[model samples]
Target: MVEAVHTAVAGRVRYRVAGLKRAPELKKLLEFRLSRTPDVTHVSASDLTGTLLVCFNSGNTVEGLAGRIAAIVEEYRSHGGGLAPGDNPGKEAGWLDTVPGLTPAYEAIKGLFALGGEQPREPWHTLTPEEVLARFGTSPDTGLSAGRAREHLTTYGANLLPESQPRSSWEIFFGQFQSLPVALLGAAAGLSLLTGGVVDALLIAGVVVANAFIGYKTESEAEKTIRSLQTQVRPTALVIRDGRMSEISAAEVTLGDLVVLRPGTYVPADARVVAAHHLSVDESALTGESLAVTKTEQPLVGVDLPLGDRRNMAFLGTTVVRGRGSGVVVATGLRTAFGGISTQVREVGETKTPLQGRLDSFSRVIALAVLGVTALVVLLGLLAGEAPRTGSEYARRFTWARAAEL
Candidate 1:
């Protein structure tokens, strides 16, 4: 059995339910609440088991709907009308309180009021579908079909993954020139000078500094480019508050806000259009098509429609190119299509660049060569007749012997 709640502010609907034989009274309470809600225009109730499916028009607001639902739940609890069969062995218990243990259906409803009407903020940092599958050990395509993947990529721009911020200029500057090669060169120079090879030490030190400078420049430039891209792709959205439309940063938007969308505007969140007049949007970000899609104010019947096919809805990061519309936000940040996509993208591991790979290999080769040269020099000197006499008497004896032989 299922009971559904459609919140206007969120533009998303969630379901709650109890099984046919498990919690019949809970289903009855949900039906009673559905009957009392004036905004609920359509309700399909099961005669045998008391399952209720309720739908609200686009004109409803999320806060308004949530308030009404909360009141109904509270009323049922006070009057002992929300008791489910076998909830308690001898006495009646609040069905809403115990619903989480009964099934996953009431979890959404329970979560709605758990924090005293303060909704959970969508996580700004999210992973892409690919990432979710990879992390959970599921097939990459299991929950993310090809069409869904494409939608996510298009809507969120390169998948809904949070970008890594580049290191600050100071960090980059300090980190540059600090490499194994440079360290080794410094060590070699210090050792050579201590052993009375000042000229060789200076030469090695110069080479090390020069190599450090080159590597530092390359790495710094790469970091700057990445930072620039991140700034360029950041999006802003238009929203309506207190009956006035204004532009604001997307991060500031919350659930239940009304966002205004027009040509060239990006949809800031997941929303259901309450007002649309010949509204056409470029959903290619989520749909992977260059063609603009016509949007309507009609209700969507199925939850299975791919984000691209949900004509009644708009998603974050999608552009409005050809029409005008206003929608009530249902999901923001991580709950939106962009957020979901971002979650997936986060799972893809970063791979080393070709240049990086080549440089690593080159560094290894140079290190091996230096070690081999040092080893050969030390080994040859030891093997040849360059051994020093141990004590003064030994040296004097060797000299006398040599002189006598001469």
Candidate 2:
């Protein structure tokens, strides 16, 4: 029994209880329950113990995830079409009404944490490209889902490349020289040189290089700014692990990790403060309000409070200007409010600069003009007798009959 408890807490479990006479029925019931819970990615049943263990991916909120599991347990108990003691099982010690509107799975887990007064931790330091690829089972050579590939590219840049992966600003800058636009520009310059327009060719080459340089610089600066923001804010969060207070890296946090916040430290992740001592945070990044907003440890009156009005919540990337508090980390990368903003920025994409648009329009116009001028020049020269000069000279040299004989 003690071993089972440890297994349940340390990992995950699904089970069915039945008399020895009903063992076959129990197996059938477990199978039916497992099949119904499609979210369970893996399931293993033990005939000896009549226990089923299910594993699921982290796709939904903790509360939702747990609710799904609870539902499965209840369904298994009621599989014989009759109510049993376990059918309407008493609520778990650490369970709450699933957060409204969340998936059953997310609600279940989050509710567990809420009732237990547990919080989430920050993530480990930002994952490198290789680590991310390994986690997702992506290969440098193998193809990936378009959406996933794009996400990886946006996050890691040339680090996705296996060799000569660009890690610094300068390497990234130089990498731009190898793109299709640069190649096209080179072709244009070569054409110009062959046509004996050395000056024009050189000018065109210069423009292409300059444009590449500007684009590289802008991207580099944006990355540097984001890194600077990350560096400047040093947030110390108090975390309880194994029932002991410990100070740890703010980024190496995970969902449901408890955090302690104090005046003057930034909130490292999205959290609901379970305890507060006159807590307040400067949420200018999220709300555009310049003042320090007060917070409380009480359950929020409304579930749908706008981020700015979530008086019981503290968000990632915000400053705690006054008071002390402890909260649970509910979300992290691509999940936190700041992470959401980052995702949105990536989704909107980088627009071409005004100069780039103008240059593109100008180039198209010039190309058409050159083609038209070349045609017009050939036609004019033909009309001026320049094309038939040899024929005319032969005609002057001999009569029609003499030219034919020759």
lDDT of 2 by residue, 138-223 (tens): 43233233344233323322110011122587776776666444554566566656655566567766777787788788878876
Task: Show where candidate 1 strays beyond 4 Å.
Answer: 1-165, 168-170, 173-195, 213-236, 275-278, 284-296, 299-306, 343-351, 362-406
Question: Least accurate stretch of 10 residues (summed lDDT) in model 1?
Answer: 397-406
lDDT value for model 2: 0.52
Error of 1 at 250 (Å): 3.3
lDDT of each: 0.54, 0.52
Give the candidate number with the greatest TM-score. 1
Q: What is the lDDT of residue 348 in candidate 2?
A: 87
